[model samples]
Target: MKKIKLYRPIENFNKNCSYEILVNGKKMTDLKNGEEKVIGISNELGKLNLRAKIQWCGSEKLLISESNNIEVIKVTGNKFLNRQMPFAGGLFPLTGIVIFSGNSELFKNIGIGILILLLLGLIGTLTIWKSRWLKVIRE
Candidate 1:
């Protein structure tokens, strides 16, 4: 038998929320804030699946590994960039467009075009963020 420990520290996001633990897509237990649990697994060597979900918000985080013994599974909510970058990137270009509109005619068009391109890039980043097509790299 293999044993693994799963722990979640009390954080602002998940401090008061109940976390549902799943291993290999099976319900393990409900963990409260600052709780830890040890789970046993079979000796088979395959992909080990781990997931955690906040009960109230239904937000989830997942981690998969080839090793059987995992020390901790931190449940992180949506990242700041994932939530705010869309608005920031989208709005920043408008300011430039307004500021440069009164400049020389040729320069004004160039500025507006550049700002439009930035808006397009913002839209593309937002699309990727919403669909979750890009994988988040955790340090």
Candidate 2:
């Protein structure tokens, strides 16, 4: 048996929501924003499947071995990604439009367009994009 440290830094803008940790398709524990938790893993299991749940199909699965002393796994999500459906959906586009429209004339068309696209792409990670809302990495 071994131990793993799961951490979620404060950089995630969606502070209100917490991530549910899963080990080998079984739920282990949950971690709030800026929180860390230590959990036991079975060495016998070998090549365990580790993942975090944001809401739905949260993140990509991570394959890890239990031979390490203590693996520090970090999970993170993009900013402005904790939006609720229907309501927050409309608000996001409106908010983007407002910001784009309010920008200076010099950067209105090109700069604002690029900024809006970037933000939309990031937000899409939670939905249509191939990437997930949360990213899992080892430190």
Candidate 3:
């Protein structure tokens, strides 16, 4: 059998908590923050399903090459879209309303419409977040 060396470089965002490593749905080892370990596996010529998850958040998965090709596996924090987008969206319409505040009644009506649209945008943002549309970049 051969051994595979997987290097997990820790970052500040992920260094606070230990990561649970899983191989093919089986718990393998617990990796401490900033710790590098050489993970050994069967030398069989097949793909390996590797997963790593922090304590509080979701898991990130990777597919190891069937052959001995990769030498280093860098693990980093999972990036998510900013949660402040909803607030920003809501504020944008309010800003427009403030700018359009005038003596004309029609202007006030239009502002109300914009406010409704802002609420819709906020709802959409919440939906997007709940659906896990955020993309994870693997280093």
- lDDT agreement with native, every candidate: 0.57, 0.76, 0.58
Judging by TM-score against the true structure, name the best candidate. 2
Model 2, span 11-108: residue lDDT tens = 62668888889998899999998999999987887789898886675788998875768989999984445443324545555555655776467545
> Using alpha carbons, what is the TM-score of model 2?
0.64
- The whole-model C-alpha lDDT of candidate 3 against the native structure comes to 0.58
Report RMSD (Å) for each prediction in the order shown.
Answer: 6.2, 6.5, 5.8
User: What is the lDDT for 25 in model 3?
Assistant: 69
Pairs of residues clashing in candidate 2: none
Reference-based lDDT, residue 57, model 3 = 40
lDDT of 1 by residue, 8-32 (tens): 6654543566667666667778777
Candidate 1 regions off by >4 Å? 44-46, 56-70, 76-139
Q: Rank the candidates by TM-score, best first.
A: 2, 3, 1
Write the number of the candidate with greater TM-score, choosing between 1 and 3. 3
| Model 2 vs truth, CA RMSD | 6.5
Candidate 1 at 53: error in angstroms?
1.6
